[model samples]
Target: MRVALLILAVVVGSVIFNFTTPFHLGQIASNWGLIDVTIWITFVLCGLAFIILGILMAWWIYTYQYQPGQLAEYEPEDPVLEGRLTILTTIGVVVMLAPGLIAWNDYIAVPEDAIELEVFSEQWTWSFRLPGEDGIFGYAHNKNIDIIANPMGIRDDDPYAQDDLVIETNIVKVPVDKKIKVLLRSKDVLHDFWVPEIRAKMDSVPGMVTYFWFEPTRTGVFEILCAELCGSSHHAMRGEMHIVTREEYQLWLDDQITWAERKAGVVPLTPVQQLGQTVARDNGCFACHNTTGAAGTPGPTWKGMWGTEVELDDGSIVTRDEAYVRESITNPGAKLVKGFSNTMLQLSDDVTTEDIDALIEYLKTTTPAVE
Candidate 1:
C-alpha cells in the first residue's frame, strides 16, 4: 500500500509539473538574461540530485523487503557526506548569485555620456522631451504652454532647453549603441514605462520622478507599453520606439524639434482650440484615431472629417456639420460609427463647448502630412 501511494504521488507530481511549469518558467527565463541561464543550470543540478536520491531510496526499499526473516540495516550519518553536501550547496548558491550580482552592478552604473530623455505620462499618453544640441533640457511647465511665451513650456532663461525637442506622438527614436537615461513622471495617475527588448522599465508616479537607463544593442522598432494599468484604455496603451543609427537619430531629433516649432507657430481658431489639441493628446485619442488619413487604423480618419458625411449607430448617416460634430465630441456613443467601437470618452466635463468648437475648427483645417 505504501509503495502504491508513493507511485501515485510521483505520477501526480509529474503530471502537474508537465502541464504548468513550462509556460511560467519560459516567461521568467525570457525576461531576465542572467536569470535565464542560471535557471537552466539550477534545473540540471536539481534533476541530478533528485535522481540520485530516488535511486538510493529505491535500492533501500528493495533490499529491505519485509519477507519473513528479512532484516533492515541502518546506516549512521557520515561527517564526510555532510561536508560534501555543504560544499555542493555553497557552490550552487555562488553559481546562481554571481550572474545576478553582475547584472545588478551593470543596471546601477550609468554611463557618463548617456543621453537624458524626460518622459511625462498623463491620462493615457506619453510625451517625450529630448535634450537639445546643448546636451541640456530647459525647465518646463504646462502653464507656459501658451503661444506668446515659450511654446511647449521650454524655459527661455535656461540656455540648455532652448533647442530641446518635445514630441507628443507614440513613436520614440534613439541612436544605436548609445546609453540612454529616461526620467519618468506622471501627471494624473501611476504609469509604468516598459520596453522588453532593452530590458528596461520604470514607474511614473504622480508628482514624482523615477528613472532608468539602458543601451540599445539592436537597431529596430520595439513596442513601448504601460506595465501598470491606468484606466479603461489600459490594455490598448501601446507605443513604439525606433532604434536607429547615430546619424539617422540625430536627423530625426532635429526634424522633431523643427516640426514642433512649426506646429506652435500655426494659429488655431481660438486659445481653447490650442488647449483642446493638448487635451486630446493627453487623453490618448491619437493612438487609435489618426489626424492624417493613415491606413489600417482602428477608427475613423479625423482629416477632413469635420465636414464629411458620417454614418451613425442608428442606420442613419448625417453630414458632420457643427452640431453633429459637437454632439460627437461631447457624447461619442450618441452616434457610434458602424465600424468603430463606442470607446470614446464623453468630454462633457473635461472639455467645454468652446473647446469642442475650436477643436472642430482646428480639425477642419489641419491635416496630417504623409511621411
Candidate 2:
C-alpha cells in the first residue's frame, strides 16, 4: 500500500508540475501551430498511457499482495484481454501519429510564389545568396570556390551568375509576410540551419541541396543557430534573420553588390599587400576572420585595425605590433582574445619567415592612413 501510494503521489505531482509550468515558446511568427498541436497531443496521450500503466501496476501489487499460505494461480493468456489491449494500443498510436503526418505534408508543400534564397554554411560561418533581376539562381559549385576572389564560386563564365547577389555577413534580411523558400548548401561538412521562432530547420549536406519554407507573420529580428556540430568552433556559428517591411527589404537588397560588381570593386593592392593576400588565403585566414569588419565572426577583423590597442582575455591590453602578430601566429593560445574562442592551430614550419613579413606588410596597408 505504501509503495502504491508513493507511486501515485509521484504521478500526480509530475502532471501538476507539467500543467503549471507549461513550455513557453516565445513569439512564434510562422505557421507552426500544427507542430505545437502535435507536440501537445503526443504529450497528453503519452501522459495518459503512463497514468494507466502506473495505476494498473499499483493496483496489481496491492490486490495480489503475498499473504501467508496464499495459493499461486498461473493463467497463461487471455485472448479477450489481449484483443482489447491490441485494439486500444492501435487507437492510441493512430491518435499520436496522425497529426505529425499532416504537419509533415504541410511542411513540404511550399507555395508557388515563395521567394527562393540560398544559404551556404561553412565550418563556422554562414553566407547567403539571392537571385538578381532575372529572378533565377546561378549555378554554384565547391570547385569554383575561391575564398578571396569568388567565395560563393559562382562560375564566372555562367551568364546567370554575373548578376547574383552574395552577402558575406551573418545578417540576412527578408520581407515580412512573404513566403520564403530557404535552400541550404554546405561548403564542407554537414550543417543545419535553424530559426527557433520561425520553426524551420533543415540540414545542409555537402554536394547536395536541401530546402524548406516558412512565412513570417510579423516583422522582427530572430537568431539563427547551427543545430549540428560541424567543428571546433561550432559554438560560434550564429547568424541573424531580420524580417522587415517590403520597402526596407528591397532597399537592403539593392545596396548589396552583384557578383560582377564585387569582382570589379576590389581596390588596387600594393605589391606587399598583394603578397600578403596570397599568404593569408593560403593559410585559410579568412575562414575565421573577415576583411569587412563584420561582427559575429569567429576572429577579429583585420581591416584597418593595425596599431590599435586590444584587450586580451586575461585583462591585459596589448598593441597590435609586428611581434604580437608573429607571436599570435606561432603560438596562438599565448594571449587569448576576449569574447572569442582560441580555435586557431599554430602555423606549421612550412610558413616561412618571409611569408610572415609579407603578412605584416599587408596588415599595415589595411591601416586607416594607408587604406
Candidate 3:
C-alpha cells in the first residue's frame, strides 16, 4: 500500500511541479512561434508517458505482491500485448517527431527579400560584414584571409568588395522586423552562434559556411554566446547583438568605411615606412592596433601614438619615444599598458634591431604636432 501510494505521489507531484515551475521559454522576439508549439507537443507526449507508466508500475507492484504457496505462470510471449505496445509506442513517437519535421521546413526556407549578414567567428572573438550599396557580397576564400587588410578573406580583384562594410567588434546590429539571412564562417575550428531570446542558433565551421535567418520583432540588445565547447576560453566567447529601428541602423551603417578604402587608402610610403608596415604585418601587429584609429579595438591606435604621453599599468606616465616603443615590443610584460589586456606576446625573437629602428622612424612621420 505504501509503495503504491508513493508511486502515485511521485506522478502527482511531478505533474504539479511541471505546471508550477518558473523555468520556461523566454518571450518571443521572432516570428517562429510555431517552434514553441512543436516543443510543447514533445513535452506533452513525454509527460503523459511518464505519468501513465508511473501509475501502471504502482498498480502492478501492489497487485503482484509475492505469495508463498501460489505458483507463477511461465508463459513469456504475448503477441496481442506486443502488438498493442508497439502501436502505442509508434503513435507516441509520431506525435512528438511529426511537428518538428514540419517546422524544420519553414526553418530552412529563407524569404526572398531578406538581407545578407555575414558572421565571421574566430577562437575568441566575433566579427561581422554587411553588403555594400550594391547589395551584393564579394567572394571569399580561406587563402585570401589577410588579417590586416582583408580579414574576411574577400577576393582582391572583386570590385564588389570595395564598398562592403566590415566591422570587427563585439556588437552585431540589425534592423527590427527585417529578415536577415546570416552567412556564418569561421577562421579556425568549429564555433556556434546562439542567442537565447531570438531562439536561433547555427554552427560556424572553418573551410565552409553555414547559415540561418531570423527577424527581430522588437528592439533590444541580445547576448550572443558560443554554444559549442570550442576551446579553453569558450565561456568568455561572448558578444552582443543590438536590434534597432531602421533609421538608427542606417545611420550606424553609413558611418562604416569600406574595404577598398582600408586597403589602398594610404599613399605610397617611403622605404622606412614600407619596412615598418611590413614588419608590423609580419608580426601580426594589426591584429590589435589599427592605423585608422578605430575605436573599441584591443590595442591602442598606432596613428598619432608616437611622442604621445601614454599611461602604463603601474600608474606611470611615459612618452611613446623610440626607447619606449622598443621596450614595449621586446619586453611587453615589463610595463603593461592601461585599458589593454596583457595578452601581447614578446616580439624580440621575431624582428631584428634594424626592423625596430625603421618602425620607430615610421611612427615619427605618423604623429602630428599638437599645436
Candidate 4:
C-alpha cells in the first residue's frame, strides 16, 4: 500500500508541475509558431504515455498484494492483451510523428517574395552580406578571401560582387512581417544559427551554403546563438538581430557601405591608418572589429576610439591610453567592453611585444586629434 501510494504521488506531482510551472515556451516572434505546435504535440503524446503506464503499474501493485498461502499464476503469453498493446503503441507513434512530418514540409517551402541575405560564420564572429541594387549574388571562393579588398571572398572581377552590401557586424536588422531568407556559410568549423524567439535555426556547414526563411511577426531585439559547439569560445559566440519597421530597416540599410565603394579605395586610409589597417587585417583583428566606419564591428570600431574615455558593458569606464591599448591587444579577454563580447582569441606567441607597439602606434593615428 505504501509503494502504490508513493507511485501515485510521483505521477500527481509531475502532472501538477507540468501544468503549474512557469517554465514554458517564450512568446513567439516569428511566423514559425507551427514549430511550437509540433513540440507541444510530442510532449503531450509522451507525457500521456508516461502517466498512463505509471498509473497502471501502481494499480497492479495494489491489486497483487502478497499472501503467504497464495500461489502465483504464470501466463507466458496473452495474445489478446498483446494485440491491444501493439495497436495502442502504433496509434501513439502515429500521433507523435505526423505533426513533425507536416512541420518539416512547411519548413522547406520558402516564399518567392522573401528577401535574400547571406550570413557568414567564422571562429567566433558573425558577419552578413546582402545583394545590392543588382539583387543577385556573385561567386565566392575560399582561395579568394583577401584581408584587404574582400574579406568575404567575393571575386573582385565579378560584376555582381561590386555592389554587395557588407555588414561585418553580427547585429542583423530585418523588417517586421516580411519573409527573409538567410543563406548560411561558414569559413571554419561547423556552426548553427539559432534564434529562440524566432523558432528558426539551421546549421552552417563549410564548403556549402544552407538556407532557411522566416517572417518576423514582431518588432524587438532577438539574440543569435551558436547552437553547435564550434570551439573554445562557442559559449561566447553571440549576436543580435533587430526586427523593426520597414522604414527603419531601409534607413539603416542605406547607411551601410557597399563592396564597390570599399574596393574603389573611396575611404582613403592615412599612412598611420593604413599601417594599423594592414596589421589588423594580417592578424585577423577585423574578423571581430571594423576600422572603416564608426560602428558596425562586433568589437568596437577603431574610428575615433583613441583618446576617448570609453564605457564598458559592465558600466566601467577606462581611457584608451597606451597602457589600456597594450593590455587590450595582448590580453584581449582581460577586458569586457560594453556592447561587445569577450570572445576575442588570445594572441601570445603569434604577436610579439614589438608588434603590439607598432599596432598601438598605428591605432593612435587612425583617429585624428580633436581640436
RMSD of each: 12.5, 13.3, 12.5, 12.5
What pairs collide in candidate 4?
A: 312-338, 313-338
Clashes of each: 1, 0, 0, 2
lDDT of each: 0.69, 0.85, 0.84, 0.84
* TM-score of every prediction relative to native: 0.50, 0.67, 0.67, 0.68
Preferred candidate (TM-score higher): 1 or 2: 2
Query: Where does the lowest 10-residue lDDT sum fall in candidate 3?
Result: 265-274
Worst 10 residues of 2 by lDDT: 266-275
Give the per-residue Cα lDDT of candidate 1 at 128. Answer: 81
Worst 10 residues of 1 by lDDT: 23-32
Give the C-alpha miss distance for residue 179 in model 3, angstroms.
Answer: 1.4
Which lDDT value does model 4 have at 157?
86
- Candidate 3 collision pairs: none
List candidate 2 stretches off by more than 4 Å.
Answer: 265-371
Answer with 3 or 4, whichever has the higher TM-score.
4
Expressed as tens digits, the lDDT of each residue in 1-371 for candidate 2 is: 99888888888888788778856566787877788788789888999888988888888888988899998799999999999999999998999899989988888888999999999999899989999999888899989999898777788888888888888877888999899999998999999999989888889999998988999888898999999999999999999998989987886776577888888873444445555766887788989987788898889888867888899999999998888888887888998778888999777678888888888887776676743
Candidate 4, TM-score vs. the true structure? Answer: 0.68
Residue 55, candidate 2: alpha-carbon lDDT = 86
lDDT of each residue in 1-371, candidate 1, tens digit only: 46744854675576578567755432221124654565567766776667566656666666665889766567787899999989998997787778767777776677788889888776677768887667777776655455444434555566666567777666778888788888886767889998766666778887667886787777887888899989999877788888888987764654464323534663323334444565666566787678768867766878767666877768898987778867777777888787788877656476666666667765665543334
- For residues 266-348, what per-residue lDDT tens digits would candidate 4 score against the true structure? 54333344345446767788787765765767788877788889888778899998998888887787777887888788775
Candidate 3: C-alpha RMSD after superposition: 12.5
